[model samples]
Target: MSTKLNRIDLNLLVYLDALLRERNVTQAAHQLNLSQPAMSNGLRRLRDLFDDPLLVRTSDGMTPTERALELEPQVREVLMNIEQAVQPRSAFAPEQAQRVFRIMASDYAESTLLPAVLGKLRVQAPGLTLDIMTPSDVSFLDVERGKVDMVINRFDSMPQSFHQIHLWNDSFSCLLSPENPVLADFTLENYLQAKHIWVSKTGMGVGVGVDPDDVQRLGWVDSALARLGKKR
Candidate 1:
């Protein structure tokens, strides 16, 4: 018989499971700590709802009907699933746990920062594993959907939806040979006058993404230069 989900009493499934397992009203009531009459009432409701005898009297004992036999295992499985669903989760014990954590980070973060974090995890969470992916390989959509556990990188801007923390302050340092003439007078004027190569991607991918030509997506140095009425 067709049944509307909202019309069904889910608790009846528990009563039905106990009834089918016990195969006798008195025994089923004992199993559930209910009176014999209460179990009998439950049986009446089950019979009415399913429109089946569900059980029958036989000389040997109470026997399950063909329909009841078919339902027995299915009912048992459903009860087991419900039991698990309601069970409270145990607190994490990292020393006794094994799990994989996924991380998405930029190349700069991967090289400069992640090594220390990995070193500590190796000692404290010996069974824990990390799956590292670069920013260029993954989109913010992956992070929003929880496919990536964490992201560690510099950002010119981030979505208000993303929970952010300030890790540390960083700045651009010029790497030049000792003989380089720029080092003679390393003032803002000398630095800007010298030819330079700008290499930064933190501002390239904003949220889901943006066009590479979008000057509004410029990185820290370029943005700072723009504020000072200059271009990098």
Candidate 2:
């Protein structure tokens, strides 16, 4: 048995996992509901016990040292084990839970998905209150800070600390009015040249801007190394 594991409070492992995932002192601290300095103190203790500079700073972000990488899986498993051991096995009875769940999401997500979730909640959790917040730049950060109970938005911006469930993949179709100046059989070049009103996240019209979802869809070229590895 490692003396470090025995001496340190096992609960700190939860914080440790969050720290590793966020790779930033301030973000990890925010997620764990601790002040940045306090989290730094806990990190110092961990560094001393592990005898390794677990997170190395770089231009882009923090990179875990070899020792930190080795310990990552063990730390995750132990924390999950502890969580399961203490958690009650009883199912969630929504009617009995008078909890208010705040959700932050995009307008499109609210229009498409939240209606079903809200309908279910209305039928099952009549006592529960819901407050929905519109999506903004820092929605994921809100989740990390526990300002919102949940969020539904583009996955690219989501931090690793929160668990994500893939709801659905929606497809996009290009639309044109019958009276448009372009030919009916619009080629790629013509489509590119067509000027149109762009919708902004703030519900304002813009010159033209690519939505994050469109960017994600069009930019999914797998890495060369990934392709090679898959072939082998």
Candidate 3:
């Protein structure tokens, strides 16, 4: 707190950590492979920077002062974070890995895609955890921030920065009772004329074109009808 950030020596943190752990100036110097005099100079600089006698002489030996004890865990944690930042990530092996993956999926995909996904995980990565969430529960911001790992569904549009892939080509079917009169004609005109049920749809991802009045997004069947300037 006493020294300006630009004027303080970052190396003092290493010296202070070693000194606190070893509790002896000569021992701390030996741990850092530095001479006793150099270590003492570092302790002086640290004291001036923090305006605290971080370590005080004791009857038995050197002991950390109250301030040094407070800084001990914080300093170790900072050093650990720096080491992790500089280290290369270890190669991942599914069989040995323990990780959590967050996925946003629609009900349709829950029935179709998740079974195989769970099967693979059960066989290869038993230790991994999957948190499958409905599309309504998350947003693109979650994906950008790594809170959500992936979204599986149709995308009307997406940000240019997103990495995308075509999982598979799929088709849809409309069911009707065999005795229905529409079975006699089975044409687009007849189908449009028939009263139909509108089930709620989801997993369309985040898009501006999804508004109900957008015409192009009025569900697959209605969107086709809209292209012909028609509505069911």
Ranking by lDDT: 3, 1, 2
Q: What is the lDDT of residue 55 in candidate 2?
A: 88
Q: How accurate is candidate 1 locally (lDDT)?
A: 0.77
lDDT of 2 by residue, 132-175 (tens): 88875444545654568888776655545568898888865667
Clashes counted in candidate 1 amount to 0
Kindly list the per-residue Cα lDDT of model 3 for residues 1-232, writing each as its tens digit. Answer: 6557678666888898888768899999999999999999999999988899998897979978888877876776676678889889987799998889899988888889899989999999999998999877888756644468889988778865567998888887879999999999899889888877656456352243356576654566667777788876
lDDT of model 1, residue 41: 89
| By TM-score: ranked, best first | 2, 3, 1
Specify the highest-lDDT model's number.
Answer: 3
Please give the CA lDDT of all the candidate structures: 0.77, 0.71, 0.81
Model 1 over residues 130-209: C-alpha lDDT tens digits?
89998877776566434677888877677566778888888777787798798888988888788765444554353336
TM-score of 1: 0.53
- RMSD values for the candidates in order, in angstroms, are 17.2, 8.2, 15.0
Clashes of each: 0, 0, 0
